[model samples]
Target: MKLPKELVNGSIIFIGITAYFLLMVILGYGNSFYLRLVNIFFVFYGVNRTIQMNVKEGQTDFVSNAVSTMVTSLIGVFLSIIGLVIYSYMQGGDDYVQSLSETFLFGGNPSIFIYSVSLLFEGIASSVIVTMLLMLYWNNRLTAD
Candidate 1:
């Protein structure tokens, strides 16, 4: 059975994010907030690829394309969060989260769960925004047959 283009693109996003984060840690810049923001490009690339594939395949319904783009981004976000949670626990659980909260937007010494949940919410919001923006760009470019 063939995998959906969204799934494949989403996995690519997740891989890119994982590699980028690991590279940051290796380069001693893991705590840099500005570097962290670069991860959004991975989501944008993956989501855009899904929409492009849909258009190439002649599936030009705006709603369906939007849904596909959202799903692609959400997959990357969910997987990345799960990886973050697991890595946090491996690196000292709440202590790791506390260190992260220092440089990140989170305040007040949150626990691992709280940090992960907060990130999940942030990821969801970004996913929605990326989806909308990409849909708007694609809508202007795609014409129904």
Candidate 2:
């Protein structure tokens, strides 16, 4: 059975993010908060690829495309968060989260649950924004009438 383009693209995003973060750690830049922003480009690339695939298949309905894009991004985000939780526990649970709280949005020390929940909310917001922006770009490029 063939996997949906959204799953494939979402996996691409997850792999890109995981690899990028691991590289940052290996290069001793894991604590650099600014570098984290670059991961959004991976999300953009994956979501855009899904949209492009839909366009190629002549499935350009705005709502469906938007849903596809959201699914792609959300998959990446959820997987990344799950990975983070696992890594955090491996590193020392709350202690690891404490170390990251300095650069992360969480004020004061946070447990792994708190950190993961905070990030999940942030991810959902970003996914929505990315979906809307990409949908607007595609809608303008492809006319329904």
Candidate 3:
């Protein structure tokens, strides 16, 4: 087995992000069961790439890649949190509470006017988390070799 350091990292991040995305979709437990299919497909692609990638012997740039991936991902997370807070504040806690009670978190409550806004916030948060993790994995993996 030609254990090249760079290739291993690539595969981990590619697969990891796909897993994370699929998990969020699964947690939905609402109406999306095909999430796993997409994730698995991505995992396959990552695996294929890993197998094809050349893990040539050289100075493994793990440290730099790790730092870049971690730092930028942290920033993404921080910004997402801030955005969520601001969005929630705009909707007003009282209104949000009322909507939550009325719609039950599905974001579709004809009774509540704020469900759409809340759903948007949730989607944004989810996007941020997904992006952050994927970014970290990609950066690290790409630089490892």
Best by lDDT: 2
lDDT of each: 0.92, 0.93, 0.43
lDDT of 3 by residue, 55-119 (tens): 23232354443343343333333343344345446657456545444435353333333544554
The superposed Cα distance between candidate 3 and the true structure at residue 112, in angstroms, equals 19
Error of 1 at 62 (Å): 0.1
Displacement of the residue 25 alpha carbon in candidate 2, Å: 0.6
Candidate 3 lowest-lDDT run of ten: 51-60
TM-score of each: 0.96, 0.96, 0.32
Error of 2 at 48 (Å): 0.1
**Top-down TM-score ranking:** 2, 1, 3
- Measured with C-alpha atoms, the lDDT of residue 73 in candidate 3 is 35
Question: How does model 2 fare in lDDT?
Answer: 0.93
Order the candidate numbers by lDDT, best to worst: 2, 1, 3
Model 2: runs farther than 4 Å from truth?
A: none
What does candidate 1's lDDT look like per residue over 2-42, in tens digits?
99888899899999999999999999999999999999999
What are the RMSDs of all candidates, in order?
1.4, 1.3, 12.0
